[model samples]
Target: MITEFQLLDAPAVPTVVVKRAEVAATHLPELFDATFARFHAAIAEGVVAPSGPPFGLYLRMEDTLDIEIGFPGVLQSPDENLVASELPAGRIASAQYWGSFDGLPLAWAEFVSHVAGQGLSVAGPCWESYVTMPEPNMDPTTIRTDLFCAVS
Candidate 1:
């Protein structure tokens, strides 16, 4: 199911991220799997956490190492390596979707439709936050994800 689009002033939160020059669509699954693993491992071991799945995660792009990804309170800025912030604040246009990441295009279409309907435009690249582990054996109909577009 698709969710109503909402423009929210999202609070910053701690995050763990990996940088890539270009993430081709063909590699999304592997990228997501590895990233999700890092996030999950952090939470499970108390290195960084919400005690469970995150409400969402942010993906920011940069031509240089000048990037930041973060969660609430804690922020990290890496130099010359595509900085990953743990806390950064901004406006977010978000939507929630259930089922596997394979259906992400549908959700993106929905999100795009919602953004247009609201007369707002997406400001940056999209981010997909896992609400459940990415297990190949899991039912595709049961996975949940929160998709977000940064708002300028």
Candidate 2:
């Protein structure tokens, strides 16, 4: 299947994140599901609390990976416990994946190839935005993800 994604510039915003390491593609669905579920629950229960227009979710990776669910606007640093950082403004190459998370790595590979083919270098870490709400009865096959790579 051909994955299609659009590139755009996204501004920095406040986010809440959880760190994990050596994650496999097979288990990513559950990881994403559980991580976002907790983030969503926090929003619903007024735990983390939402501050602005909820649009993008970012994943920052090095040796380990950190998944950050970004809320729109600048969120307050409650008890000064949040790990919020301002991501510098830059160009990004993005694509939309409308399927199970199993195919996400491949989709991201395509994005990387596309960026390279354009003679562009990656500027920052990559992340996937969960643009749609996950339903209990919904098939993972029908889930949607927006993969993004920061570029210069």
Candidate 3:
């Protein structure tokens, strides 16, 4: 997939998140599903309205990955396990990926390379904006994810 490079002035996003450290790749789907369900439940209870697509905010990616999976919205009385947080706003490099989530690593790799090609440096943890929800029978090609990396 072709990775497009662009700059974004992202605003602070109020979010409800499920944080996990050293998460296994195989467990991601379930974690995301559970997190979304909880967030959706909050919405069902009239806690908050959805303001943006679901996102995976990566805090670390070394021997283990530390991340948060959640939805952005206006703050509400979150449940015990959910915490309200803000996505920092600043200059970033981004690209839209039109394919399965499985292809994300490749897209990110290209996006990073593209950023470097432009003489920019990554300054913070990367995040993925899940633009399209995937269904079991859905075509993988139809999925869309917007990737972002804070840059200096």
Per-model TM against the reference: 0.67, 0.69, 0.91
Task: Looking at model 2, report the run of 10 residues with the lowest lDDT sum.
Answer: 73-82
Model 3: lowest-lDDT 10 consecutive positions:
73-82
Instruction: Give the Cα lDDT of each candidate.
Output: 0.58, 0.61, 0.84
RMSD of each: 4.8, 3.8, 1.6
- What is the per-residue lDDT of model 3 for residues 13-68, given as tens digits with 9 covering 90 to 100? 78777788998777788988888888788789877666889899998887678998
Give per-residue CA lDDT, model 1, range 23-134, as digits (tens). Answer: 5556655755565566555545555534234432434433322222222322133323223345335888888788777787788788878887887887765666666656
Off by over 4 Å in 1: 38-88, 134-137
Q: What is the lDDT of residue 79 in candidate 3?
A: 73
How many clashing pairs does model 1 include? 14
Is 2 or 3 the stronger prediction by lDDT? 3
Best by lDDT: 3
Q: Can you give the lDDT of residue 66 in candidate 2?
A: 53
